[model samples]
Target: MSVVNPLVRAEALEARAYQLRIAEEAIKRNTLVVLPTALGKTVIAALVAAHFLYNYRDLKVLVMAPTRPLVLQHRDTFLRLLKLRPDDVQVLTGKYDPEYRLQAWQGKSRIYFATPQVVNNDHSLGMSLKDFSLLIFDECHRARKNYAYTRVAQAYISEAPYPMILGLTASPGADREKIEEISKALYIEHIEARTEEDEDVSPYVNPVAVEWKLVRLPESHRAVERTIRRMLDDRLQRLSAMGVIRKNPKYIFRSDLLEAGEALRVRLEQTPSPEERGPLFAALVLQSSALTLYHALELLESQGPQTLKLFLERIKSSGKAGHRAIVSELVFNGVYRVLESSDLEDHPKVEALEKLVLEQLSSNPSSRIIVFTQYRDTSAYLAARLSKLGVTVVRFVGQADRGQDLGLTQDQQSLLLDRFRSGDIKVLVATSIGEEGLDIPSVDLVVFYEPVPSEIRYIQRKGRTGRRSFGRVVILATEGTLDVNYLVASRRMAERMKKMVKELNSELHPIIRLGPAPEKKPIPADWIARAELPPSSPETAATTFEAELESVEKERRAKFNRELRETARRVLNSVLTAGKNGLPFEELCTELEEEGRNPVAIRSAVERLRAEGQLMKKEGRLFPAGVEAEIPGARRHVFEVLRVQLGEAILRVDDSFNAILLSADYNGPRELLRRGNRFSAISEIYENDKARHVRIYAVEELSD
Candidate 1:
C-alpha cells in the first residue's frame, strides 16, 4: 500500500482540530461523528482512514457510503489525498461487474470505497469482508433497519479479525431515538458531536441563526387547508383499516395522499360564484398537493394558459376519473368558474418570486443561483418567467422512463452544473434531484419555490448555499395555507439542529442570525436577449452528420425487420437468464411491466439463461445483458422522466427541454413521426406524483 507523505497528509490536520481530535480519539475506539452540513465530515473520514492505513499495513481500509456518487467522491478524494493509483483503490458501485469485482476483492487493493449495497450483495455471494482493517460509514445517520448498511456492518463485525468502524455524518438524528438507532446500526462505542462554538471549531465553522417567517394564509385559503388536512386524515384512517397501511407506518401507506384530498375540494367548489370559485378551487388543489397556499396562488396568477392546459392533459392521459372530477369541480364550481371574472396577472407570490429573482440578480450579477420548485410544470413556469427577465435559466430534473415523457438526466444535470461553473448560465431552476451530492455549481442563492417536509431535504437545500462564504437563501411561501406550516416546520427543524450542535459543542456559543428580508424588485420587460453564437460550426456539422448517419442506419435496420429484431424479447429474456446483476433487473422488470409486457415471463427467461452461461454478472450488481467480447454494442435502453405539465405541449418533448440527456443521439419519435402523430407518450401516467410528462420511448417504440 502506497502511503501519502506524513507532512502533506498532516496539512488537513490543522483545519479542524476539534473534528480531527475527536476522529483520532474515536479511531482508538468505535465512534459516531455527527457534524452539520459543510462541517467537513468527509475530512474526518479521510483522516481516520489515513490513520488506519498507516498503522495497520496488514489489513485494508474499507469505506462504505450510501450512494454511487458518494462512493465516487470518497474514492476520488482518497486517491488524490493519499496519492494512491486508481488501480490501487477499488470503487465498487452498482455499475461494476460483480464477478470482476470479487476477483479484484481477492487481491491486494488497500482501499475499497463502495456503496453498502455492493458490500452486502458481495458478502451474500460468499465474498468476505474480513480482510479490511477499518470500516467507515459515510452518512452514518442512514444506517437504520433493513438498509444495506445494517447488513454490511453486521457481516463485517462477524467476519473481521480487527473490527474498526467509524461512523460519519452532518446530521445523525433530529431527536434522540434516531441518534441511538444510528449508533446501534454502526455498533458505535463512542459519540463525538461538535458545534461551531467549540474553541477548536470556532475558526472553521460559523454559526447560522435560523429565522421563521410566517406568511398568513388569506382566510379564504386557511379554510381550504383545514378541509384538505381533515380529508387526508380520513383517508389515512381508511388505509390503516384496510391494512394497506399498518399503524405508525414510516410515512402514509399510499403515495398519493394529496390526490385523496381532492374530495374535500369538490365540496368547496359547490358554493362559489365564478369570480370567487375559480381561484379558490385552484388554490385548493395546490394546497391539497402539499404546496403552500402562497405557492399555489403564485402559480394560479403567474403561470398562464399553459399551466391549466398541462393540468387538464395530465388528468385525461391518466384515465383517472378522480383527477378529472376534481379539475372539473375546480373549473365549473370553483376557481375556473371565476377565471373569466378575475385577473391572474395580479397574484401576489408571482410578483414576490419575480421581485426576489431580480433583486438577487442585480445585486450579485456574477453569482449563479438555483431556484427549486416541487412540480415540473411549476419549474417550467418559473424558468419561462425568469428567462423573460433576461437571465439565462435552465430547468434541471430527473427523467422518468415508464411514462410518455422523459425526466431530466445525469448529463443535463452535469452540463448545467458545468455551464453554471463557467458563468455561461446565471440561474438553474431545478427539482429535488439538485438537492443531493450532485456537483451543483457554487451558487449565491437558493430559492425554495415551496417548502418541503423532509428534514433531509431541508438540510440538502440549505446546504447548497453558504458553502464558500455567506450565501443568501430565499423561501417563497404563500399566505394562509400549509405554506405557513411548512415555513414553521423548516425553521423549527433548522433551529433544533443548531441547538443540538451547540449543546454538543465544547465552548461558548454565539447565535447565528438568518438574513433579513430585502427589498423586492420587478422583472424587466426586455431583460434577456437571445443567446448569440455562430450557428452550425464545424463541431456542430460533424455532430449533425454523425446523427444523420446513425438515423439512416436505424431506418435501414427498421426496414429490414430482421428476425433478430422480431425475437428481441426472447433474446432479452435469454440475456437476463444468463445474468441478473447488470441492467438493474428490477428496473428493467418495472419498465417491461409499464409496457404491458409479462415481467414474470421475462424474468423467467433470464433465469433460465443464467444457467446456460451466455450471460455474465459483474461486481457492482451490474448485469451487462450480453458477453463483452461477443456482443460489444449490446445496449440497455434507459429512460428519464423529464417534466410533468399540460399533456399536449410539443416543446416538452424537445431534446433541449430534458435535463437528463446522458445518452448520445437517442432515437426520438419526432424524427420519424409527422406533426400531430398519435403515438403513446414515452411513459404511462402514475395518476399520482402528478403524471410525469415524458418517457424514454424504447428504441423499438420509435420504429413502431
Candidate 2:
C-alpha cells in the first residue's frame, strides 16, 4: 500500500508499516530514529515532513546533512515525493555566497535542505531558525562533540518557537555514553529503532551473507615488520625511561602514547626553567616519534608494503622533527634498504581480494561491487590492480587533495556512481568517504579491504549492499594482526549498540504535547493556484534554476578574481621593488595586512604569482621570477618528482608549487625522474602564460 496525502504525490511512496509507525511516533515528539541502512529512514523523515507541511502551512521545515551531495539528495527525494513547487523548496550549501544564502533563508521557501556547517555559519551571522517548525538532523550520530550538527541543533532548539527535532541515522554508535550525548545534544525525547531481525523489518530486508577471508603475511614481510617494531620499541622504551610514559613497551597502546604526550605538554607549559623544559621537550619529540612509528607499523601490518612505502616517502619529505627522526632511525637501521630491495608487490590481502572479486563477477556478470578501504593509497592500488586484470574499476575518494593524489570532485563522484549504476563501471574502490548515507541500490557485493575498528563504519560498509536484492559482503583481513582485532572489536561493538538502543528505547518515556494537536489545514489556495498555473514552457522551471545557479557561481568567481588580482598586483609590486635582495614572506604578509587586504586572499595571490613565475621564493624570502639567475653560485632546492615528459620532468616544490625540469639541464640518472622520487636541483625561473615555470640547470638525486 502507498501513503495517501495531499502533499504526497499519488502512488509515490510505498507505505511500509514500520516506517509509518515510526513517523507517527516522530510527529508527536523529538525522536532519534535508528534503523538499518537500506531501510526507510529517509522515507520516515519525508512522511513526517509531509505531515508537518499539511498541518502547519505557516511553518517551515529544515533538513540538514553533513555533506553537500547528501543535502542535494534529500532535496531530490523531497521534490519527487512532495507536491511542493520547486521555488517553495530550496537547497543550501557552502557553494552559495553568504549574501545569497541570507536571501534564501529569508525567502518564502517552506522546506529547506542544507549542510550543517553552512547553517551553523549562517546562524552565527544572524540567520534565524525561529520560523522553522521541524528540524531534521540526518546522520545525527555526529551531533555529539563540537561538530556543527550540535551547534545548529542548539540554535534551532533555542530559537524555534515550536521546536521539533528528528535525528536520523543507521547506526548512532557502539558507546552508550556517546549515544546519550547525542540524545542530549539533539534534545531527543524518544527513540524508534529497528533491526533486520525485527518482526516488521525482517519482511522488508533481503538477507545479506557475510564472509571473512583471512590471509597470512609472508615471512619476508614479517622481517620488515620486525625492523619497524624494533624502532617503535626503542622510542617507547626511551619515553618510559624519561617518566613521560609508564606503560611497558610491549603492552603500550596508541592511546597511552597520546595521553602521555598530552600530560608531558601540560607539564612543560607549567615549567619555567629552560633546563627542566629541555627534557620535557625531548620527551615530547620521543612521544611523537613513537606515535608515528606505531602508525607505520599498523600500516605495514594491515595495508601492506606498498602503502607503507608511500607513508615512508611522505615522512622523508616532511620537515617535522618527529618525521625526520623516524626517517633517520629507519635509514640507520637499514629498514629503507630492505623495503626498497624487497620483491613484495602487496600484502596477501590483495591477492585474496582479487580472488573474491573475480569469483563474484564470474558468477554474476551484471553485478555491481564496491570495495572500501581505509586509505586512499590502498584504494588506488586496488583499483589499478583490478584494472590491470581487465576489470572496469575507478577509485572514488573525497575532495581533499593530498601531495600528489587528487580526489574526485562532487560532480565527478556523482558521475562515477551513475556509471556504476548503469553498469559502465564494474567496481568502485572507495575510501571512508563512501561509508555514509549514500543511497546506492543494487550493489551486489561490498568488500572491506581492511576491517574498520569503528562499528559505525562497519555497519555503513555492510549496508552498502543488500538493498535491492540478496547481497554479499567479503571482509579481507590478515591473520595475527590488527586486522583480526579490529574485526572482532567492531562485531562486539555492533552487538552492544543494538542492546544499548533496545534498553534506551524501553527506558524513554514519550513526551505529551502541552497543547491540543494542531488541526490539519487544507492546502493553501495560493499554493493550489501556483500548482495549477502552467509552466512558461516544458523546461522553464529547470532552466530558471540552472540559470540562477550559474549566475551565483559567476558572481562568486568574479568577486574572488577581483580580490585575487588586486592582492597579487600589490604583493608583486612590493616584492619587485625590493629587487634582487628579495623580501621576507612574513614581511610581505604584514605589509598586505596593514593595507587591510584579506589575509587569505593575499596568500592565494602570492601562491598564484609564485606558480606563474612572476614571483619566486628562496630560504624564507620572496624575489622576482628569474632572480636566481642573478646570483653567482648554484642555488639548489629539493623537489619531489611528479612525472616525466619527453624532454622535461615535472616536479613539485614545497609541496605546493609545480615546476618543470628540462632533460638537457638535469645531470641526474633517469631513474631519479620516477614519480615519488626526490631530487635537489639548481633551477632557473621563467614565465609562460603569466605563470612561473622552473628550469633545472643541475640535479642530484636525494638518497632515502
Candidate 3:
C-alpha cells in the first residue's frame, strides 16, 4: 500500500493495478463497471471522483447508493480516502430537510453521497446536476423503469454539461436485454468488467467454497404435501369451471393465474356493457383465487409447514374467502387435521439447514453466518428452529411493518448488523432486504435458505462472503422442488451475464467525451425556495364556485334544517306509533316518498339523527346505535347475507360472491357499497338466479 500523490490520501489502501486501470478508463466515459464484490469498487469510485475534482476544479461530484446505510458508508470511505475538507463531503437522506439539502448542494458539499430517492426529489425541486462533474451510481443494476436511479441518471445526462456516469454493480443481470436497458438508462457505453479468474484480479481474490446440500422430503411431510395438493386441485378445478382457465389445474402456475387475472381486469375495463363486465369480474375472482391457492401450496411444499400456517392465518383474517376456505378445510372438519399438532416431520430443508449451521459453528466458533430466506415467516421459523441447536439466531427482515416479527426498522437493522459485525450475534436469518445494498460486514458463511432463480439475487447473496477472507457458501435445496431449477438457472445466468457484458462492450464504443465542459454558473438564491405552483385549472375553478354556492346554500338551509329536524321528529313519532319493531327499509323509503321529501335529503337527516344517537341502523332499518330494536325474527328483513360469511357456512356465497361482498358486504365492504359505482344508484348489481330479474343488489334498489 502506497500513496500515488499528495492530492489523494489513504496510503494504507494498496492501489491495485486492475482497479486503477479500469477507473482511469471509466472516468472518461459514461461507464458501467461490473466488478465482483469486495474487489475495491468503492475505492475506484473515490479515485475517479478525486481525479475529476483535480482536473475540473470548479465542478462537484455526486455518488449515489440504494440505501442510507450504504450512503453513509460510502461517504465515510470518501472522507477517509479523498484529501478534502470534512464539510465538503455530505450524506443526504430523506431525513434531511429539503431546504437544508438544496443549500448543501449549492457549495457546502463537493462530494455528495445520497440515496437515489433523495437525489431525485431534490433534483425535482430545482437542484441542478450541472454542478457535478462525475456521477457514480452504485448498485446501478436497479436503475431501470421508474426507479429513482433512472430518473436521476436522466437528469444528470440532460442537466450536466460534461456528463460522465460510472454505474457499479456486482453483476448487472442474467439477461442481455435487461443489462442493455440499464446501460441505456444511464447512457452507459464503456463497460469495465473483471472476474476473479481475470489475470489482474486473481491475486486479490479470496476463494469461496460453494456447496449444495440436498435434502429429500420424508413420507410424513409428503402426506401433508398430498393433502395440500388435493385442496389446491379442488380450487383450481373450480376456477377452470368459471372459464378462467383453459388448461388443466395441474398445469396452472402463478404466472398463468396472474396473467389471466390481469387479462380479466383489462377486459372488464374495455367491455362497454355492464352485463359483459360482470362475467369478466367473475373470471377475475377465480383467477385471483387460483393464484392464492397455488402460492399457498408452494409455501406448504417448499417453504416449510409453519410458513404455510402463518400465511393462511394472515389471509383468513384479511377476509379473502378463497384462502379462508382452503385454510378452513385444512384446519377444521377436514380429512387431514393432523396439522393441528406441530410434531409432524417438518420441512426437510429446515432440518438440513440446522445440520449445516451446526457443522459451520463446530468448524469455526467465532464465525458470522447469514441465512437468506425468501419469506419473513420462513426466516422467523428458521431462527426459532436454529435457536434450539444452541446457536445464536435472529430474524432480520425489512422496514415494512407486517405483524411483529416480520418488521425490522432501519435503526433495528443497523443495531443488528453492528452486533453481527462484532460477533455479538452468531447467526442472522434474513429476508430479501439482505440482498440489497446495505453496509453489511464480511461473513464467514452465506447460506441460501432456498436457491433463488433471479441472477441478481443469487450473485448478491454469494457476494456477501469471500470478501476479506476465505468464505463458505452453502445452498440448501429440496431435491425435487423448485430449488433444483433455481440452482441450475442461477449458475446458467451468472455465466450468461459475463458473456453478455463482454459482447455489449465489444459492440458499443465508449462516448469519449460529451462536448466541451461548460463554465460553472452561479446558483440562484431562490434555488432553495419552494417551487411555486401554476394558476388553477378549470376543474379547480368550478370546485371553488361549487364550494361558494354550498356556503350560501347552507345559509338558505337554515330554514331547511328546521324543517328536516321537524321531519325527523315525525319519523320518530311514526316509529313509536307503529307497534312491531321498526318499519322495513322499503316501507320507510315509501313513507318518506309520500311526504314529498327528497330521498337524499331524507337519508342525510337520518344520518344526522344516527350521529346524534337519536337513531341507529339494524337489519337495514333505523333503530339505535347501542340499543337493539324490538325487531323479532319476523321483523325487518335482515338479509343476513354477509353475516353468514363470518359464521363460515355460507354455501352459495363462495369466493365469487365474497369478491362482490368485498365491495358490497359490511364494515369495509358496506362503505364501498354505499359509494356505489358511478353509473347507477344501485349499491351493488350482481347476477343471481335466486333473485328476480336474475340480478341482485346489495342494498335492494329503492322503489320510485
Which candidate has the highest lDDT of all? 2
Deviation in Å, model 1, residue 477 alpha carbon:
1.5
* TM-score of model 2 vs. true structure: 0.75
The TM-scores, one per candidate, come to 0.58, 0.75, 0.70
**Best candidate according to TM-score:** 2
- Predictions ranked by lDDT, top down? 2, 3, 1
Model 3 scores worst on lDDT over the 10 consecutive residues at 672-681
Q: Per-residue lDDT for 137-200 in model 2, tens only?
A: 9999999899999999888767765688899998999999988898888888999989899999
Model 2 — which ten-residue stretch has the worst lDDT? 695-704
**Per-residue lDDT over 1-704 for candidate 1, one digit per residue giving the tens place of the 0 to 100 score:** 22222412343234556765776676666777866567677767777776666555556888887666567667655543453433346667766555445545765666888888888887886688877768998877779879988888888878775577788876665665666577777777677877556677667654343333334343433333344344445545554454433565225523344443454466565766777666545545433433322233334423333454455455545544345544554455345433444433333455567777788888878888888876777777788888998889888777564254467554455566778778899888888777765444357778877777656677777777766677677776665545666667765775576556435434322222123222223222231111111256745743554454356435433532342232334444423333323455566566666765443344444444344443334552324223332323333332333332333332233323322222222233223233432222233211224433332323222211
What is the Cα-based lDDT of residue 448 in candidate 2? Answer: 96
Each prediction's total of clashing residue pairs, residues at least 3 apart in sequence or on different chains, is: 62, 5, 1
Superposition error at 33 for model 1 (Å)? 1.7
lDDT of 3 at 629: 30
Model 3 Cα lDDT, one tens digit per residue, 362-431: 9989888999999988888889899998888888888787777547666678788878888989999989
Model 1 gets an lDDT of 0.56
Q: How far is candidate 2 from the true structure (C-alpha RMSD, Å)?
A: 15.0
Candidate 1 minimal-lDDT segment of 10 residues: 525-534
Name the lDDT value of residue 429 in candidate 3. 95
